[model samples]
Target: MTTRNIVHLDADRVYWTTEVTYDRFPARQLWALAAPIHELVIPARLRHAAGASRPGDLQHQLVTTFQRRLGNPVLSRLPGQTLLETTGRSSGLPRQTPIGGRRVGQEFWLVSEFGERSQYVRNIQADPRVRLRLHGRWLRGVAHLLPDDDARARLKSLPRLNSTAVQAFGTDLLTIRIDLD
Candidate 1:
């Protein structure tokens, strides 16, 4: 299993985590794990932090300030909005793929191609408890979700899989979300 380290930033602090077995995993599943958490926490965390001023508001402020100044930078460090990783399941090695393409603008928006048969997609459908990590010049954040409706909608809106990109490796393209982060 391949282990890929990722970073996440929330309203409070940053975190670092590893996505084990990424190379063998599929992209769709990775998105499913990440999309909902990104959609709900990111915005709420930002808003909660914005008005912070005192000790009680420090957590909110931290989240807000980080989102305002470091959100994009942190996101840019992600391998991609969608990622594949391996995990330990009762049946030997099970792949834990998280999908959800992200776009970084004034805020980060996540997208995905739903209904695609992939390990990452299936993982999300079966279980939404996933973790994310963000590494930065000086800080990092780790995030996860218990599962929620807001995340489901965000996943549903992901762009369809289509398009192509020609790079040094030659012609390579797949249905992916465009994320500025």
Candidate 2:
């Protein structure tokens, strides 16, 4: 039950080493078990505070920073992961984001955790035309924001891991339907 503290270049990357009662203990495996518990047990008051359209507080910054700096890079490289490429509203540059969604026939569907406040969602508003990467291929598509769609119900129909994340961290849920070419 000894704890070891690891400090990286940044505070966000800090890792604490801890011994668990599980057999064949490994740091990665321990983390794999602890991460979900940590997220799920977040206080309701904190979740509510962090789940605003644009939260300027520390919690929101911490979550977004870790995801952008670490999570996105890892998820984007995974096989069969869906990616959404949107045109930046002001910069007019291609902004590629790794997303979770399902492809059914000629349409792809997903929900945004941050609703219109998400960067990708805002980009889609600027220009409905977008591109999607799925099954190792890039394809053109048009994005449609479905405000009327029930986000919680939509999560039930999406991949479990992503749906769980959306439910845990999302402040405002937004549904997006992409018509593929």
Candidate whose TM-score is highest: 2
User: lDDT: which candidate is best?
Assistant: 2
Worst 10 residues of 2 by lDDT: 11-20
Q: What TM value does model 2 have?
A: 0.68
Scored by CA lDDT, what does every candidate get? 0.38, 0.79
Clashes of 2: 0
- What TM-score does candidate 1 get on C-alpha atoms? 0.24
**Candidate 2 regions off by >4 Å?**
1-59
Clash count in backbone of candidate 1: 41
Query: Candidate 2, residue 2: CA error in Å?
Result: 22
